[model samples]
Target chain A: MALDFTIIGYIAGTLTTFASLPQLIKSLKTKDMKGISPYFVMSFTTGLFLWLIYGLFRNDYPIIIFNIISLMFWIPLLYLSLMDNLKNKIKINIK
Target chain B: MALDFTIIGYIAGTLTTFASLPQLIKSLKTKDMKGISPYFVMSFTTGLFLWLIYGLFRNDYPIIIFNIISLMFWIPLLYLSLMDNLKNKIKINIK
Candidate 1:
């Protein structure tokens, strides 16, 4: 319950938030999601959203703030990945 | 602050942890990490470790437990990704 430890949690959450940015840039730049797993994307996005809700319930500012920001980073990637998956599926069907 | 809310946090944590497993299974089965971003994996793994530490500092069992378990899931993917990236680098150097 020390204030210092909560600071550490904030830092950890920040790193987790930062870590996803590069991947987002990569996804946006390449527009390639073949290597991206949709199931994970869907699950991760949903889970983070749930975390945001959990944060709201607990009034945990760090959790709410980080999860929402993380969701912002993730949503586009999820959209792109789903689009790619759908396109690939269509291609396979056509062939 | 409420017990029910903490339970929700636990569920969120579990889902976040679970989200990575399918990705791990795919990585193991296909041995393809092209879509897997190493930056995220390393940062996430380190962040989770920090979260574990944060948990210890706060004496919060859930934070410690989920992060350690999440580490177990992420480490292999990180190793595989670094290996794949290294292989590609070596291939480029040879060519």
Candidate 2:
């Protein structure tokens, strides 16, 4: 039963951790991120960073591992979203 | 030291869990979910549900509480995104 729960926890962690990936892929392919909210990415990435620190302090392997992976995906997404937002602002200013 | 880590964990959990909220509010205000990926929501929600179950099995209160709140936000976001996607498809079909 304990092992079963561990399996479930890992699966859950995997799903949530990779959740941002599809959006990242879509944004990369289209180079269009008009609909993605910059605030969302910023908040999430910050959260993930803190989670990593928390995991380290607590010595929680699952939290540490998954959040590291989550950060890998989200940091890029956050960068893209910020860049896209900046581009849009510049375009608006130029116009 | 342990208490400090607990504080960090809660803060991290709160930030990550509520990360989707800004997007949800944006979508609600503008009714524009075009940038929001349906796949992301679907995957994230599934992960949250599983996490909730995992929390229950592990008797982890923080996990259960945060995931439940995350679901409250995400489920609505998921519904809106699906509805928007459907509307877009219908519009395309009519054209």
Candidate 3:
């Protein structure tokens, strides 16, 4: 039963962690942050961070592993968002 | 103990379900699907669909509720992606 639980959790984590790839690719290819909300990413990342801490405290490797991967996925998005802001700033300044 | 588990699950679900808001807003505002990867959303939605099923089998209301809300979040994304495709098709057809 415990093994079943672990298997379930593992499968769930794997699929979700992998799911971020499409968005990551999209962001990378277009380099356009206009349609992606910074706030959503911000809140989601914050939520994931807390979940990571929870998983750590519980010694839940699956949760930790998944969130870590998610972190990798989100960090670039936030960075891209920042870059977009910078570009906009430059554009406005030029104007 | 069950109460505690329920509380934990609810908190987790609430935060996650709510996290989709920013992305929805961003998508609505920019109407630009270029930066968002359709494949990622597709896979993620598929994963969520399975999770919802699992939750249903387990009678896990939290999971069911969260995924249903997530469905709400993702459906729009998929729709937006389709619209973007349609627009592109029109553009190509015009050319």
Candidate 4:
């Protein structure tokens, strides 16, 4: 690949890493996972896992780096989602 | 690439595409775009565009297909976001 093309990949990866930040921020700020979909997050996280694996196999640093950031962004959301579910269950149990 | 590897790619793409569906649905249901981030969406969309282009350049069908579905999921969110912003602005202006 040309230097320019490689640079483009870097740019793309950077943009994607940044793109997921808002959801991360919102999830943090609101602590409300009500509307967020669990299935979607799981699937997206899985996809990122594959992307990370693919990056590793291909030895693509950009892919690896971007996915690392995405994982960081996603894990919290997933954890919060699970916690919300657990809390709801406890409420139901108490009721 | 091995057949197994190709299948993995297919599965990964399918999962990611499905993952984004819930957000699309929620965005549609609530029509609430307050928490969603425009910058993230813009950056993610740009990344998807590049992914599409990269897929085209490499003749990678999986990347292309996944991104198309992702685009479908994202564009509505983006539209809803813009519409909400406009609506809020109009309300403020009327006041």
Candidate that beats the other on DockQ, 1 or 2, i.e. the better one: 2
Error of 2 at B80 (Å): 1.5
lDDT of 3 by residue, B1-95 (tens): 44654455456556666888878877888787877777777777777777786777677787788888999998898899878978998999999
The DockQ value obtained for model 1 is 0.70
- Model 2 / residue A41 / CA error / Å: 0.6
What tier of docking accuracy does candidate 4 attain? medium
lDDT of 3 at B94: 100
Candidate 2 lDDT tens digits, B1-95: 78999999889988888877887787778777777778988999999999999999989999999999999989988999899999999999999
Candidate 4 lDDT over residue span A2-93, tens digit each: 66566766676787777888878877888877766677778888988887777776677877888889999988878887888788889999
Native contacts present in candidate 2, fraction: 0.80
Q: What is the DockQ of candidate 2?
A: 0.75
Fraction of true contacts kept, per model? 0.60, 0.80, 0.50, 0.52
- Model 1: number of backbone collisions: 0
Which consecutive 10 residues in model 4 chain A have the weakest lDDT in total? Answer: A1-10
Tell me how each candidate scores on DockQ against the true complex: 0.70, 0.75, 0.48, 0.58
**CA shift of B68, model 1, Å:** 1.2
lDDT of 3 by residue, A1-95 (tens): 55665566467667777888778877888787887777777777777777676676667787788888988998887788878878999999999
Chain A TM-score compared with the true chain A, each model in order: 0.94, 0.92, 0.81, 0.82
RMSD of each: 1.7, 1.6, 3.3, 2.5
Ranking by DockQ: 2, 1, 4, 3
DockQ-better candidate, 2 vs 4: 2
Best by TM-score: 1
lDDT of 4 by residue, B1-95 (tens): 65655566577678767787888898789876676666766788888788777777667787778888888888777788778878989999999
Best by DockQ: 2
Give per-model TM-scores. 0.93, 0.92, 0.81, 0.83
